[model samples]
Target: MKKLLTLSLSFVLASTLFIGTANFAHAAKAPAQPAVSAVAKTVKQSKSYSMILSALAQNDVIGQFDPTEITANEVGALINKVTQENPQVLYYKSANVWSNGKIEFAYSLPADVMKKNRVALDAKVKKVVASINKPGLSELDKVKAVHDYLVLNTEYDYANLQKNTIPADSYTAHGALLGGVAVCDGYTKAAQLLLNKLGIENHYVIGQIGDGLHSWNQVKLNDNYYFMDVTWNDPVPNRPGIIAYDYFLVTSNQLRKDHSWIEKNWAVATDKRYSYLQTGKTAAK
Candidate 1:
């Protein structure tokens, strides 16, 4: 019997595949295997993660490799790591892992559509980064600029989320950057793309918010890690010209009040110096 494991991480476009292993939340709710633990776990298996990433980067739709007898959970972790690392590879969504080490990916959009969206997304990302990541801007400043830009521009896809009619692009950075609407996944991916362009160190986080699935980002500033959730900062109902910094550059303890994640595949964020609320920077602004 071939075991088929379907990994769904709170994405808007998630669908139920044949029952096999774990069932993760969609992007609306977003991630919680604690950020620090997620990073630690993935590090131990970095070799396998790198190999899978290399193949995906080559745009190979389906590939086979010896992952050295990984279980369903490990397969899920590996796929999540790759997705987190390469947010630009937004076309690929879910991974279909077989017992024999054969891996197939299900794309969120068709090839032709993805190609067009990729071009548009890349152009938009370049423009946005150039505008926000100005010369001599400190890392914190750059992160804030991108965070505010995203919140001010993109509106959460409440309509689709409520109607269960979410568009494929709404789950990717392309939607957040170009379409002006997205879910948490889209927001996180867009942040990842912008930060990568700015040369800021960051990682994508997959976890949960009180039993609900969600996705976010953790960024490195002056060697200290901090969590950022761009989606939560961007209010629903399409509020324009308002940016919420509640979750901006926050520590794990601060975020843990409402957000919970697995403690296996990410970095523990404890720095509070850059937290917008910690220094009362929001009050001054």
Candidate 2:
């Protein structure tokens, strides 16, 4: 009778342990999946030269700075002309057009500057591009996806801004993701680059905000313009304890209060119907 009782007690103890293990497994949380929008699409891989030409052609005035007018030497200097033998990327310099003697087209990095920063920038671009599985995404959705990703990944590094070593435009998406910190300009430019890759229309606006120079983005979504400030959305790096969204999705008036921009820098819509918020106040006739 004592031996029978011992066996029964052992079986009860084993049953209790098994029940505890099942409860713990059920309570564990799963990893969060990336929240992709309906509009996200995959980016097509293009040859280096093709990508450069495509960017140039898509610019507002390619005819003004005709490629044909440029000499072979100038073309070679401006474009690396990627070949099998020379796998390394090349830098291109801005040239003068017939009418506008020294027209500054798109921004260019000097050969030395490119050489110094190329490795860092390339690694950053590759990583950020690889993060999203952009397949069959619409233009508007692509912009939103990038905007969301930036806000979620990067935090504002106010100390970096204080040092003035890193600007808002300097941070690429990859850097922001890996480092979790960036200045305002870096946040804006990184978002712009990724959105452009997805064929979304966006503009980088640099201007004075309050007393200091600042940078932000104006993206065209569904035929309307909306402002996004990723830097302000992320947590302040030095003060990670706090998070702010004062500037995430702001209206023109709100932006105008703190940010004054040169009219030429922005592609202001003529109709005013495309403005994000209407106050019933019209521009001077």
Candidate 3:
């Protein structure tokens, strides 16, 4: 009886051990990762301006600009100039004109109209442009130039903040340069226009950030991508002036920390440093 009992006990213990080992092996196999969708996947692995333009065009968000109206040689020259000086002032003509002898670009508005509306913004852009000397710059330099210009010239107006009143399309470079005050959309639009003239492919990204609607820019440089937020970079009203560099040249993950973009329109970035910002603090792992 004792020998039979010992044998039976040994068998039971062996079976339990085998079952435990099998369960461990099963657990060790990784859970199947969720598949990324075609739309959700990034178009370019890096943050180049061309790649950014391609992505924007693919998404159908960039507003229609008559390609024929833009001269190729002029565009090339502008790009070269921007890459060299990182100028705050950009050349603008109502219609395309190639000749270089004292070109006077005309606007129908009265001489004092800009002064009455937002004179400071105009002055600032002009001053910055005159100061910049770089041309044919990389996308990163373009972003930095705009970012610095905005920071130096603008201030956030909390009292004027309205959900729907912010004008996006009308904010010209002259306006932003002079007043140093504009809605998020205004800041972004002006940046887009200036960058476009420089032959840098940039997109005016409209999305939600925190509890408010916001507009920003995404630029491509050297086959890589980065985000720029001129509005957020500006100092808050009635505060010691400080520019927020957090949004400058940041990845999508870093932006997710304080801002949330639409899933369909969000541009994925190759830089992984900010990826943790996307998923809350859980990304710490």
Candidate 4:
């Protein structure tokens, strides 16, 4: 799911890609904006990042900025940065940037659904973390705890994907954690949130699998980086008590055979000490 095009009149630019969800839906050009007394600052400026994050958490549109701070082509990069860096920010699906200095992000779920479900989602996250994290657990063990939990507990949303009626929650942590059904983005976001809460260093990754866009994660364990794809590890039929570790903790050479991503965008994953295939083990206790 990717789109990059420029409009003649409004100079509208929308970049929408949430992997298997929405399938690169287009964002219409917004109406003209009212004048502001002062130009808005870039998100990199002190305090501006937090303000924008807060607005995004509430599914609000952020306008009144200097369009020069972010051009149309750069909007997609910004959206990815925000979601990847801040795992808790799970609802944004795409971004719309106009030459008139207005920008808005489209969310996977509606504003009302987000408001109604966010609290419950937060609670579920805390509960799951509490249940799995224990004293004296190693970092590797913590990572495995998250990976195993997602693979064993959540069912892939194959029905919706086939029917093209995927609910917005299916693209979010809420669906993976609460609804127990999710696609690639949902599984990745849920893993990102869980790993962050467990004090693990990880980042969500975007890339291509065959012709379709996909989402996964990269983790730093024992000072070595590795990629983990919880979605793929969970089989499509979703057999009970079965978890596949084929995609767990693999290095760049191993993953590149099947996965393709922009090298410059992510950290190079070359270490294999923690790879499940090589060690036949994921963690110690």
RMSD values, in order shown = 6.3, 24.7, 24.4, 8.7
Candidate topping TM-score? 1
Clash number by candidate, in order: 37, 16, 33, 0
lDDT of each: 0.70, 0.43, 0.42, 0.65
Query: Candidate 1 — what's its lDDT?
Result: 0.70
Residue 47 in candidate 1 has what lDDT? 64
lDDT of 2 at 280: 26
- Quote model 4's TM-score: 0.76
lDDT of 1 at 138: 92
lDDT comparing candidate 2 with the true structure: 0.43
Candidate 4 lDDT, 1-285, residue by residue in tens: 333333221112221223311121111111122111111223453243454466666778563233445555544444444545565665665556555645666666678878778888889999999988999888888898899898788998877766666666777788899999887777888999999898888887766665545778888987778899888776556676776676789998988886777756677889877654543323222
* Residue 251 in model 1: lDDT: 88
Q: Who is ahead in TM-score, 3 or 4?
A: 4
lDDT of 4 at 131: 84
lDDT of model 2 at residue 167? 34
lDDT of 2 by residue, 132-235 (tens): 54677666556556766776666655444445344322333334654666555457767777766666676665555444445577777667666666565454
Off by over 4 Å in 3: 1-127, 135-138, 162-174, 238-241, 272-285
Top lDDT prediction, candidate number: 1
The ten-residue window of minimal lDDT in model 4 covers 22-31
